[model samples]
Target: MENRHAPDSLDSIYSIDSLRARHQQLAAQEPRLRIRERALRLGVPEAALVAAGCGVHARPLAGTAQALFRELGTLGPLMALSRNDAAVHERHGRYLDIQADGPVGLVLGPDIDLRLFFNSWKHFYAVSENGRHSLQFFDRSGEAVHKVYRTEHTDGAAWDAYVERFATEAGLPVVAEPPGAPEQAEAPDDAGALRSHWLGLTDTHDFFAMLRHFKVSRLGALRAAGADLAQPVAGDAVEAMLGAAAASGLPIMCFVANRGIVQIHTGPVKRLLRTGPWFNVLDDTFNLHLNTEAVASSWVVNKPTSDGWVTSLELYGADGELIVQFFGERKPGKPELPAWRSLMASLCAQPLAA
Candidate 1:
């Protein structure tokens, strides 16, 4: 992707040829920056930068997002990646058992699991550079939502065939405008009523609807849910939790997302390495790189489910965006692990003051 040959000049920079040239220049100069970051620095949509190189190593992909995603299984073992500004999740495995209904989709496979929201999915492209390959999807605003990449376990021929079949002509995608500022709803006065509904919840999935009914933000609802339901904990507790989990051979579920898709890692995380701001899990099949500096708050939330009370470690960004979350590994019918509960109890023994 670096220095794909420069244009005659930097003139007409937004033009397709110029955009391609400038993109490659920065890619070579700033090799550490992702395409999304490079595009943002260029003051244009990342999808547009991709569209500009349509006839080269980039190919615009067509068909419904679900349809294209279904073809991934045939290409053999690969890598699935999803990220936001602060976290990057990469899982390696074959894409299997993908199901979609209406605007939502789920990939339930032992190796690569994901919860996808199709409504936010827009542009798709098959990109290859220096033998590296990936099918990248972007939201309507050109922000990346998800990506499937060719891995060492992948058959190169199979990957090439899949891309060839789905490939379409190159042209800049028509993207949606970014949304306006969110209107903050006044905090509901019925904290007690909301707490009642929250406490009586039969499933954690219902918590979202409960919040909607109360017209309260998630952080706000947490504040009103009382200390028993939610409580601020030491932000540094993540390290302690992970270290303990690793030591005890405890399997956990890790979730990282942006607006379009949620990528999950289920099982045990083995190797831990810290590089600068990133706290990473560098397991063979699953890798998580989290920019811990972005964390502004951390909360221990206990939600009542029919099986039992489920607890999770929720970290938030400075702008109130969810950075990442953690929970003891579990299935629908299973109760929260007693071990996990005990671990969390120890972590939450001390809480923020009134």
Candidate 2:
């Protein structure tokens, strides 16, 4: 069911040109196969596959991240997509209020909310298939950072202008070295100091700095601070959380992030569907696919904000990676919703799954 060819072995047999030709042939017949999965099977980066189909199927884009993002707003209606290995998040809207400073960028809009880190974003392309066009960006590892696809309401004239402005010569994408293993951070021995900083946190943005100072992972920090600051919750609480949110019509926020980008969904989710190891939220404008099996631990973390005490449900993977997060939908100058907070408290009281 899966291709088992090693990268080196495939390289020894097929030249780059032949591989590209073969990819095209396969792609034509198996249009449903996702390019990312196809690339993994071929032992190549996903961007490489898309790049191999340049000229006829795709075009290269050349420019700085800031310059390119600023132009995206002109594209009118588009679909923004971001996904990790276990989950995918997609939103259909316009990219607005784009601000880029140094290596970071933010899309602060009612729809299409994203926080982007551009340091690893090195390759860009405009891909066309089956009459659909999308601007795709990738990190050094050839992993997708973000993608924007033109919708029926999108401005065709603006799309053409953007393509004409950034088009480049057709060629294969440049590959980067594989990502190195993350540095092992040992937890601080001073539990009191760690708890002091944790309890003193006034903003969620400061959480990362606290982790850096304690030299610990998020779960480690939660453990060091004990149950009062960060309480251990049953992993199955996610299902209950989603169900309650849908039943009560409670507006909430869901955050999913990869290495180079984080995507957010606000408002309410109505549909909750499950299939095997996957749990899905299939709404009209939003879709979330989460692998429940990959979640190793879940915690309910609270932080003091100017508005009040904000709470969150954070899920972690086996390797200490943050998988996804959930919170009550709230904006600046507003506190979290009372209904959502009540639901979390009730869910937290439930016994752990055996």
- Best prediction by TM-score: 1
TM-score, model 2 to reference: 0.89
What are the lDDT figures for the candidates, one per model?
0.81, 0.80
Clashes of each: 0, 0
Q: Which number leads on lDDT?
A: 1
Model 1: colliding residue pairs? none
Give lDDT: candidate 2, residue 156: 95
- TM-score per model over all chains: 0.90, 0.89
Model 1 lDDT tens row, 62-149: 8878888877888889999999889999999988898875589999999989898998788999987667788989887777799889
Tens-digit lDDT string for candidate 2 (103-222)? 989998898899999888878888897788999888877778888988899999999899889989964444644665554354667889998887787677898898887777777787
